[model samples]
Target: MSFLELKNIHKSYHLGSQTFPVLKGINLAFDLGDFVSILGESGGGKSTLMNIIGGLDRNFDGSVTIKGKALNHKNEKALDTYRRETIGYIYQSYNLISHLTVLDNVLVSLDMTTLSKKARVLRAKELLARVGLAGQIKKYPNQLSGGQKQRVAIARALASDPKVIIADEPTGALDSENTKEVLRLLNEIASEGRLVITVTHSEAVANAGTRIVRLADGKIESDKRIRQAYDRQDKEHLSSRPLRRLASIKTAFKHFRHNLGTNSLIIFGTAIGLFSVILFSGLGNGVSHYISSQITKVANPQVMSVSRYVKDSDDDNALSMSTDDTPALSTNQLDQLKKQKHVAKVEPTYSIPSATVSYQNQTVKMRYASNWTAASTADAIKIGHAPKKAGEVVIDQDAIAKKLDKEHYQDLIGKQIQLAYQTNKPSGETVTVSLTATISGIGHSDSKGAQVNAVNTETLQKAMQQAGLSTDPTEASVKVDTLDHVEEVASSIDKVKDGHNRLYKTSTIQSLIKQLQTYVNIATFVLSMVAAISLIVSALMIIVTMFMSVSKRTKEIGILRALGESKRDIRWLFIAESLITGVLSATVATVIAYLAQRGINGVLRNLADYTFVQITFRNVITAFFLAIMISLLAALLPARRAAKLNPIDALSAE
Candidate 1:
């Protein structure tokens, strides 16, 4: 039995409804160590016969038997395996990958073998040295001479130790001296106990082999042998497997570096979109922090102001409404609030929409005045102390500076001031109430143009009683035991109700800060979304770039497929390249965001005494993964198109 055999092979090509015959019923046989040449004219179907024998043209009627086992041509995986493990091809055009060096060109085949990486490198070097191109290993194909390029192709054909080597017009592009050198190499390959087949139209090239088969008009005309086959030997061959994902990624990176200028621009474009998102997120965080700090300076976090829940009331002055319109908390409600968990104390308070203070026969209108409670912090008073006694009050520093004394504002802390305000009685009549109290402290508000004055609850209530008006608690300040319990206690107070209507509404410094932060977040999200429109453009750019890559690398795809790389392997090659692009873009965006954060914060700190941008680790990581996901999604259509290409047609592409 022969080492390899072909029986009754037939093939044709279809142009619309017409069929053109390429290979007519041809039978051939081969043995190990035989150098056979298929000699023919240009259109004699010699290459078609070679393709059938090498397992590349499977759409035919033939039984390709090797060592008594016929190939299952219908099974693509089996055909790929046969090509990987049993056959090797050398093209006359020297179809070397342009981006790879000579050494890497040969290792492309060796990457599928079951050898360690170090061992693969050593073997590649050995093969290059054997071909007399060891010193040229670092040079690319375009940098090598024709003879040197042919030598590289020869080394690559033998990299996997395939049993049968197929060369298609190997010397057609070489000079006489290079042709002679290449024939010597083919003869030497035959002597290694392997089957060597060459397709050539040159009679001189055909005679260099041991046997010759003449082909004409898609049929074999004659078969002649001048010498016998070489002696056979038993040896272990190099094992082959499917291409690994890491190998595909390495190749992709090489291609990426080859096209760095264009890819760098893409990375920069993508980075701008991601930078805006990260910057906006950091700005929101900083604004929240600043607002919380400012409010906490004037108000206690552990104390919350509680009032009656009014439905659909848009009154701007509702907090300072007259006693008749404002809902007064009953004794029962006060007892319930004091009984709540985490509640330390509940103090009733009163307020008026407007008031006036008389000092040394000069009068000035105040914005508003209320009784002091736990909700008012001592930290707000810039001088003197909080109002403690019934006859003491805290006046805003700005009011004193503008109305009474500009330079001597602190001197008015111990002076007596007459305060008067108006309220409504139960009979629907309004009257004025007056009280005299000492200015015990001067308060300050961080909010611009806000003037708040405070007096003791006892003093205000005493003045109201003397005016024949009912003085009930209009609001209460519920003091929590700890700052952390403020939110919980406030929620409980808000849930207090009379039948279907909610009884009380709770407000805290923390709640105010949260509301302000919510507004900031909405604005940040809107701006970030607008910035994200650029990301769509960036994705389109990536998609266009990958499609262009697929068009440019069509021939490279054929070479890989012929080397037995699976469709899945080809798909991941493009995906890996895009992923690298994404990661680099995200890294650039992160660096830019950090730099912008520093620059913006530097200027804002000098003007506002606060840092206004704070980028977090979560933002960086979110941007990183978002970039990767977008790139991966963008690569899918192009990669699939690449994987679906026909290996035979791809190898024939220019």
Candidate 2:
């Protein structure tokens, strides 16, 4: 059976305004080790027939059988596999990948192979040696002669060890001497037991083949067998060029250089986007960390102990402390708490109605309930020191500046202010208990979720008892550093109070910290998502740039596509271009994001003592993934369009 057989091939194209038919009905057969040359006019379908045979174009109605297996029209995978594994091609324009080194160009087809990089290099070298280009393996396509480049193209074709080799106008671009040199190489390749098919106008190329096939108007006109002269080396000028290597990374790098400008711009755009997200994410992390540190700094631990209750024992009390009729503690009872086994410090607190200020015959109505906290912990003071005595008031800056007198914001500090304290007893008793004090110092405004109006705990308890409020040791309040010693502390207080004294270990600062953390997380996430849009734009920008590039490079891609590369390989080249751009952009974006976040953090530190964390490794990795996806997505359409181009029309395009 023949190695390749074409049975009644027919192909046409829609030219917008008209239909152009190239191949009428073509029938041909060629045996293994045969070399056939096709001569055709410029308007003829020589390149079109080549495209069909090479599987780049399947729109034609025909059967191209290789090794008795007919090419499938419906299954794209089958066609791809057939093209990948079966065909070897060299084109008239040399079609040497311009960006690849001579050696690397030979190994491009073996990317997915299990053969080690070194093995692939070795094989590529052997093929280049066969084509007499062994020394120029590291040289780029432009650096080689026309004849030498064609030889490299041939070497690339044979690298996969295919049974059929097709050469379309292999000598078309060469001078007479180089043309003769390339034709002789073809004769040698065919003699080595592989089918050689050539399409060209050169009679010499047609004569050199062992079997010649001529085409006119896309139909086979003649098929003839010819003799090859003995002592082929006499006509073959041999060069001892060492084998070339398939430098995959190096090849990619060259294309990267060739298309650097367009890619860099797209990458820059994407990087800007990632920068916004990374900075915001970092901001969130840093803010939460700082807030948590602050919370722990001020928190005193709570003491926990079980309570035993009587039936409705003290239910009649108004400022009620009794739950299930529990009685309250006396001053002596509260003082006895210090003697408990594991007791540390205990303080009692009572509530009062909102104080009404009377100054200069004017009465200001106060609304929100007034409360206080233990002033022992220094971290609780955001302004001047805690109240030195009961008559001294520590006013927060927020209250003095905004709530009091905005015109004389700072004047209120250190001034005497009268407080009319109204007390409510647990026994449903109400009394007008008031005090006069001076604003000793101004404190900073406390954030939300903080316990406001903190004062000295000891003074607070005395005032509560005077107002007939509960100071029960059984329900006493105490603060410790941690929850670890709650049981020990609770056991000691159990003796003084009627019921177990419950140490309420609530962290006001901690609540604020959680709020800060939530704000940061949301801010960072939102910013990051918004930044992702820029990356997407950058990706699509690559597609647009590539499409424009394809428009500019249509002929170049057409030349490569006609060289028997599968549509995937063609598309991959375009994708490869975008992929390089994406990676580069990621690297740039990460650097920019780091610098940007750091700069913003520096500004914030100036406002107060603040430390902001920089963008994480996680953020950088995310940017990388996004860049790749964007670049690939951008390349998809242009690559597909390039792959689907008809070689004949492409070649015929001016």
Candidate 3:
């Protein structure tokens, strides 16, 4: 059996129902160590016949048998495997990837082997040395002479140790000296027991080989043998495999570095979009935190004020103050609240919308006077302290400024004050409850709202009882163990119901803090979304850049396909480039955000005594991955288009 055989091969090209025959029932047989050349005129189908024998042109009606095993032209994967394991191509144009050095061009073929990386590099160096371009391995194709570039191509073709070497007009573009040198190399390759096939139109080029098969009018005109074939030798060949993903990534990086100027502009534009999003997120977080701190200073976060639910009332005073018509919390409700989870203590208290206070001969009317409880924080008191025992009261700075001694308010702390308020009895008769209380502390208001006047609950209740009035508590202060449990405890309290209506109404500093935070979050999300619109532009830029890359590297794609790289490998090459761009852009965005955070916080700290921009670790990671996902999605269409290109058409593209 022959090493390779083609029987009754017929091929034609179609143009709108018209057929042009290229090959007609051609029959050929080749053996190992045979240097055969297919010689013909320009329109005689010499290259087409060579393409069929090299496993490149599979759309032909023929049986291509290799050592008695017929090739399956219908199965593309099998054909690709056949090409990778058996055939190597050398083009007249030298087809070396421009971005790669001579050594790397050879390594591209070796990358599809099962050899170790170290062994692959060593083998590539050996091939370059054997091709007489050892010192030129570090140079690119444009930096080398035509003869040297042809040597690189020959080294690359021999890198995988294929059984058949296909040279298509290999000496057409060289001078006589270079042509003789290339022909000698082809003879040496055939001497190693491998079949060498050359396609040419020159008689001298064809006669340099062992045999010549001349084609005329799509038919073999003559089959002549000029020299005997060399003796075949048994030798081990390098194992082959599909290209690895790491190899694609390395190639992508080389292309990325070659176009650094354009890629840098893209990275900067993408970084601006990401930086705005990150900065807004951090700003929202800092604003929420600052508001919570300021509010907590005036009130205790873990302490909430609870009152009996009132229907259809929008008045704040009506919700909190107890009246003859309004319901008050029963003993049962208070006991249930005390037994609730995370509840530290519950204290029943009273509130008076209006109260009169007199010290010596001076008198003043105070608003929002209530019994002192844990709901009030000591931080609100600018002077003295909170009311601790019976007969003690804490008056606001406003009352002192109105009627009391505003200039010497500290003098009233140790003095006694007369307090009186009007309430209803059980029979619905209005009566006045008055008592003498010591002014233990004076409160102040930082906000524009009214200040609170607090007194001991026991003192007020005792006075009400002595005045023949009901002393049932109007409100309760529920103290939670920690601030985190305040919301949970409030939720449980809200769930407690008397029939269909809620049993109690709850209010706390924590609830106000949460409402403020929700507002900040909504604003931040809206701003971030607006900033994200710029990413759409960034994605489009990447798509354009990738499409340009595909257009520019069409020939490179063909060269890779001829070297045994699959279509999937081509797709990943572009995708890897986009992903690298995304990673660099995200890194630049993170650095810019960090620096802006520092600068903005520095200025705000001097004005408000607070940091107004806080960027979390979560934000950084989220931005990084978001950038990668966008870039990956953007590269898909261009990569797919690049992968779907026809290898023959791509190779012929100018």
Expressed as tens digits, the lDDT of each residue in 442-547 for candidate 2 is: 5552334343344344454555566665545334455544556555555444333334554222222333445567777887777777877886677678888888
| Model 3 lDDT per residue over 1-654, tens place | 999999999999999999999999999999999999999999799888877887767799989999999998877777778878899999989899999989999999999999999999999999999989989888989999888989899999999999999999999999999999999999999999999999999899999999999999899999999999988978998889999999999999999998999999999989998888889989998899888877776667888878877767574222255666667677887898999999999988787767788888888887778888887788878888899888888888875534588677778887998888887776878889898889888887654465858888889889888889766566788999998898899888878886888877787776677777988999999999988998888888999999999999999998888887878999999999999999999999999999999999998777777888989988889889879988999899999999998777778777
Q: Which residue window of length 10 is worst by lDDT in model 1?
A: 315-324
Clashing pairs in 1: none
Q: Determine which window of 10 residues in candidate 3 has minimal summed lDDT.
A: 315-324
lDDT of each: 0.88, 0.64, 0.87
Backbone atom clashes (below 3 Å) for every candidate = 0, 24, 0
| Tens digits of lDDT, candidate 1, 62-101 | 7999998999888878878888898888889988999999
Q: List the candidates ranked by lDDT, beginning with the highest.
A: 1, 3, 2
lDDT of 3 at 140: 88
lDDT of 3 at 562: 81
lDDT of 3: 0.87
Off by more than 4 A, model 2 = 12-21, 112-114, 130-132, 228-254, 300-456, 463-511, 516-533, 549-580, 596-608, 625-629, 639-654
The local lDDT score (0 to 100) that residue 488 gets in candidate 3 is 92
